[model samples]
Target chain A: MAMDRTEEDDNLPRRLLDGCQRDFPLTPRPFGALAARLGTTEARVLDAFRDMRKDGLVGRIGAVYRTNTVGSSCLAAIGVPLDRLDEVAALVCSFPEVNHNYEREHAFNLWFVVTAPDQARRDAVLDAIEAQSGLRVLRLPMLEDFHLDLGFKLSWS
Target chain B: MTPDPIDLRIVEATQAGLPLVARPYHAIAERLGLAPDDVMARMARMQDLGAIRRIGAVPNHYRLGWRANGMTVWDVDDARVDALGERIGRLPFVSHCYLRPRRPPSWTYNLFAMVHGRDRAEATRQADLIRAELADACRAGEVLFSTMILKKTGLRIASAAAE
Candidate 1:
């Protein structure tokens, strides 16, 4: 559902998206703390979350783990013939380890991120993907992360 | 920081999402039979150790009006990539910047940055700025706009592997 942003209701959703992108309260009553900070009631804050979630605006309210800190991860790409793109993509997406998979315009047309508890396991998944897809997997492990924050401010226009 | 059994349990419970409640930690604590303070403290420690990046809402950028998402890749001088990447990554429009190994013959772009905008034009504008910034250091680059999101999900550590 698209957000019906009126003058009054718009600010809360905008504020909630911008303010709570990171550093959300780690307290027992987090919504209560967020409510106090945002100058709203606990119930109202909870309601906003529910509404936003139902609208598909909010992905989740949870912990974002640091890369390579919790587990090993790599950006992988595979070149599939245009005709077989859908088939290849489905095979790649079958693994739970593959969190993100995208079809981009390139010789290496299919790109995805594979994450596992350790390097060995991550490689194993990649090998399996290559074998199953009948395509060579180009494993590109992150050598360095320059800009890591994935959050962006929302413009309520 | 290696996650203890309790920490793993916490991650498993909340990886999907935190319960939407007044006292989410307390609810999690109840499920695990631990004190609310214990759960909170552990989470705090994890954040401090860089195990947990943050505890917050993750808004879908596409849903939030930034529809054009481009995976801008660059083939830059490997020797100078670290310094150049730092500069490129600092740009407000670039959300994620990373250095990944280049595949020979078929692929040569090693630096990857994701730029987002409300539309294709805005996203391309950002990519142009990045190209200009890189200047002579960049030999070639391509902005592959995502046609579709095939799969998207939060990273879930296998419970069996957690032990």
Candidate 2:
């Protein structure tokens, strides 16, 4: 069984996450800064990070990968009926290159991101989605990414 | 390595949607019947394996006053792409940068980046900074602004086979 939770446990990840990137101090005992705030020793904090990784809590401790900076990509959606939502979505999502897929409550039932090696392939993917799903694949190519940041505040409490 | 049940469970919970609150993980813990620390620990582990990416926000740029946003594609020479990409990505205006799988023949640009600004001219200036760095190496480029936002959300972790 996992260890029992205490109130103190809830305030650690947020601190580390906050300090990890923006205000990371460049000095010895780097973990000390985090450890001091997290109420655990530097080693425990380090070990905690190791344990978290072992436990599958975090995906990475690096820079967030921005999805739009590659070849060519577009956001596409299709309005599948409630009955065929799953079926049509699967067809749209069949391509391995489709990075993100979602089931939205909006009129266009299934939506996903089609990122290709280039514009032609990008359009081809949309065409393929339309062909396979039998639904109008509304292609909304991004004009600009005004504010895209994947940084979420994961409070430890 | 393959993911464990706990891994799948964490992904399932996280994938469904983010709990709108000051403390989402704790709320997620309440919903999933697992200790909050357990959730955090599992997330740390997934981060290590690269099975999942970083956890962060999906802000609406347009709503935030950055009315102009464009996905800028660059046709940089293979040799200089690395350096130019680094410079482009460092600018606060540029949100994303990556080396995509080379889709040649029709599309020649391998280096891609995005710059968002409060308005069209501002966005163009942000792109200009990148353009200056590339100089003539930037053979061609284009900016396509979003006409409509069809759908946007946190990623869903479910595979079709899940159902």
Please, what are the lDDT tens digits per residue for candidate 2 over residues B13-113? 66533443334567767877988778766666665665544553233455545667566667888777777777776667676776654444534556667
* Fnat (0 to 1) per candidate: 0.84, 0.04
Please name the candidate that would achieve the greatest TM-score relative to the true structure.
Answer: 1
C-alpha lDDT (0 to 100) for residue B34 of candidate 2: 87
lDDT of 1 by residue, A31-127 (tens): 8888788776677789899999999899899898878877789999988999999999999999889999998877888999998878999999999
- Candidate 2 lDDT, A4-82, residue by residue in tens: 5545555554455455543322223445556675666565556555544444444333223233332466766676798
Query: Residue B29 of candidate 1: its Cα lDDT?
Result: 89
Considering every candidate listed, which one attains the maximal lDDT? Answer: 1
Off by over 4 Å in 2: A1-157, B1-5, B21-23, B48-57, B160-163
**Model 2 interface DockQ:** 0.07
**Reference-based lDDT, residue B113, model 1:** 94
